[model samples]
Target chain A: MRFVLALLATLLVGTALGLAATRWTASNRQGFSAEQAGPWIAWPKAGTSEAEPYARAFQARTGYVPLGGGDGVALFALSDSDGRPLEGNCAYDVGGAVPAARFWTLEAFSPRGRPVAGPLGRLGFTSAEVMHDAAGHFMVAVSPQVRPGNWLQVATPGRFVLVLRLYETVLSASAFSLEADALPAITRGACR
Target chain B: MIFALPFFLGAVLIAVMVHLASLLALPGFATNDAYARLGRNAPIDQVAALTQAQIAALDLPFYDRSFETAVCKYDLSAGVLRLRAPSPDTMLLVTLIARGGNVYFSVSDRAAIKGLVEVLVGTDAQIEQIEASDKDDEVLGELRVRAPKPQGVALIRVFAPDETSKARAAEEAAQASCQIETL
Candidate 1:
């Protein structure tokens, strides 16, 4: 009788733990974040056949199609340069010289992975459409309020994520050597 | 209390072992994933052009508005899948994503010969059969990739770059074909 009770207890505990572990890993896995460019995290091996299991699970959960090395690189940032979570209630000044690429786009998304809709219906800024200063540097203002010159409105009242996609770039060849300073800087501004 | 301690320790050990086993098994059991969502509109072994509404319904993460995409759900157990697309004026990218969402292979327009990108995807056994059946050197020269999984997605993306080119891009994407080949 004691032996049967112990086996039953073990099976119950094991099944419960098994289900919980699967859920936890599926939700929390970030894949490879070894390469950080400023606040953005790039997974150099995200889409490859040899991708880590966690990466593959995350991709399955999010449904984001990651381009391979030869295609392009997609970098994601969940926080500001100061390491604070990116809140939509505050304004931000994002500017810097990015690594060379044929085309690039910067967009703000809600935590749910949809574009944060705003009043002007502008969801993102593209390299071809954004205005640049005399020195060829670009700046974008991210906020809920209306702003001038390369504005990506964040209408969400909660946390948001920034995705930077660089298309047809040579950076994939030397992704590990990329410096954080080479990418854009997101400085937190005043909050309401 | 002393008797309870042994039972508690035994339970903890069983839990830990179960947790590790579950983690390893999760990927295999994960259905209704991204590939499944993308494959919903596409029939197995046939290509389907994704409408804008369907794309919005999928709610895919980081989907670019500048690109028109198509999808094909392939099951290698049935037969080999042959994908062919004309090279777009701007850019054309084709990717094979396993059911677990890991991209096993991708090819771009730059690799196309005479504005055509043609690839055959199959299992190891199917590939061997194809090799034995096809004696033509020119046909053998075409790209053939082995799928790591029995079922997966074949995605084709064509860049539009602007609103004016959106229709053209969608038409170009529609022209791409995915068909099963019998060995």
Candidate 2:
């Protein structure tokens, strides 16, 4: 009976540790395939055969269908430049030149990855629809209140993340480590 | 009960092994993977534009609201899958993923030949047979991509800068053809 108890305890402990390790690594790994530039994060190897197991496990668990090499890379920001988690109650000014890509899109998602709801169904901004300032600079505002220029009205009552997809990007492996200044800067504004 | 050093050491070893094995095997058994989530979002062997409502409800996340998107499901057992798309007016991309959610391949309209982008997807043996049957010096228009597995899904994304263009892009995406040909 003592031997039996020991074996049962061993099995239970082993299974729990195994499952927990899997979950922990999958969620927290900054891994070989992932690239981070400032607050933005991307898995450049996603959807390719070279993707590491941790990346694959995360994608599998989350059901994310990442853009492929031919389509360019997608980056997401869960926080501001100050590293605070982006809350919908707070406003942000996102402006700067993006990496060289033929097309791009900017959008917001809830912490769970759902699209953030906004007024007039204005969930995000398209490269074509946004108005550019002189010299072709672009800036977008993300706030509860509508702004005069390019704006994505996000009003969710929870933390949100910004996603920027660079379609047909020309970024080589060396150029992917783009400086924070190269991409848009997410500056926090007054919170509600 | 007295604690035995040998038993404790043995239990620790077992736990470590289980941890490694589970980590490596998670993707194979994960039920919520991208390809599985694609179920019912699009029909098999045909492409359809996914509406904002449809996309919003899907398990797929971080979808771009600025662009029009569609999906196609293919089963090689049915036949060789052929995807035919016209050279997009602005930008169009197709990403092909195998059953386990591995993105095997992707292409843009920039790779199109003569204003048409075509892809023929099949298993290695099937692709070899198709190539073997082709006559020498005869040019085939479609790009041949080998599937690592028997089944897969293809996602089509079209970029539209404005609302009017989005409607046009959605129509064009819905019109892209996904067909099955006999072996």
Candidate 3:
């Protein structure tokens, strides 16, 4: 009877530990931040064999097909420049000169990876479509409410993530360690 | 007290082993992984254009709307997979993703010679067999990649500069082909 009880206890503890480990890994897979530009984090080795096991598991779970090393690079920002979590109720201005790239796009997604819904009927802005100033600089307004300039509508009263993708750019490999000044600045505006 | 300590230590060892095993097994056990999801929607050895609705439904993180994308589920055990696509004016990228979402090989439109991008994906043994059989360098000039796994995803991305060009980009992406070549 004592032996049976010990076996049962081991099994129970093992199973519990297994469950906890899986959960922890899934949530922490994005921990491998190869580069950081302000609040944005870039995982240069995300889709390669060199990626961490947790990153692989995260990619498997999220269904995100990462861009190839030679194709492009993707940067994600879950917080504003001040390191505060990007809340939907708050307004933000994402503007500045980006590094040299053939093209780029900025999108807003919810925690679940779906595009946030808003009144604009648009969820993102590409380099070609966004309005540029006379100085050839571009600024994007991210808010639940509609703004006059280039605006990317996001969900209100919630949190959202910003994904910036540079297509066919030289920033994939050697430029992974980009300075914060080289990238755009995401500044928080006002909040309701 | 000594006997109880041994039992507790054994249980702790078992828990640690279980934790490591679970961490390593999560990717294989995950059903909704990118490769699995793409496989479920598309048939093997054929390219499937992902509609905007389908892309949204998948909820894939970092899916750029500026590019039209297509996916092919490839199985090298059956035969080699042949991928062909025209070189677009802007940019066209072809990537091979393993079952665990690792990108093993990729090429851009700039690498295409003669306005065509051709890639053959197979195992190392299969690739060797093809190389051995074909003596002409002309036939083997097309890029050939050794896939790590027998099953995975072939993705093609076409750039669209603006909303107006999106339809054309999707059409171009649809024209890309993925076929099984028995070698």
lDDT of 2 by residue, A1-192 (tens): 988888788778777777787787765552456677889888777756777777777776777777776678888899998899998998899988888888788998886678776857877786777778886668999988877788888979888989998888886433466567778889999998
Superposed model 2: Cα runs more than 4 Å off? A1-4, A24-32, A172-175, B1-16
What's the CA RMSD of model 3 in angstroms? 2.5
Q: List the residue pairs that clash in candidate 3.
A: none
Tens-digit lDDT track for model 3 on A1-192? Answer: 997887788778767877787677675556355688798888877755567676777776667777777777888899998999999999999988877788888998876677786865786888888888887789999988888888787875788899888877768654467778878889999999
Give the C-alpha miss distance for residue B25 in model 2, angstroms. Answer: 2.7
Chain A only: TM-score of every candidate?
A: 0.91, 0.89, 0.89
Off by over 4 Å in 3: A1-7, A31-33, B1-15, B134-140
Task: Name the candidate that leads on lDDT.
Answer: 3
Instruction: Please provide, for model 3 over B151-182, each residue's C-alpha lDDT reduced to its tens digit, 9 standing for 90 to 100.
Output: 89988889887778889898888889988888
Determine which window of 10 residues in candidate 3 chain A has minimal summed lDDT.
A25-34
The docking category that best describes candidate 3 is medium
The true-versus-predicted C-alpha distance at residue A157 of model 2, in Å, is: 2.3
Instruction: Assess each prediction's global lDDT (C-alpha) against the native.
Output: 0.80, 0.79, 0.81
| DockQ for the candidates, in order | 0.51, 0.62, 0.62
TM-score of 2: 0.91
Worst 10 residues of 2 chain B by lDDT: B1-10
Worst 10 residues of 1 chain B by lDDT: B133-142
| C-alpha lDDT (0 to 100) for residue A55 of candidate 2 | 70
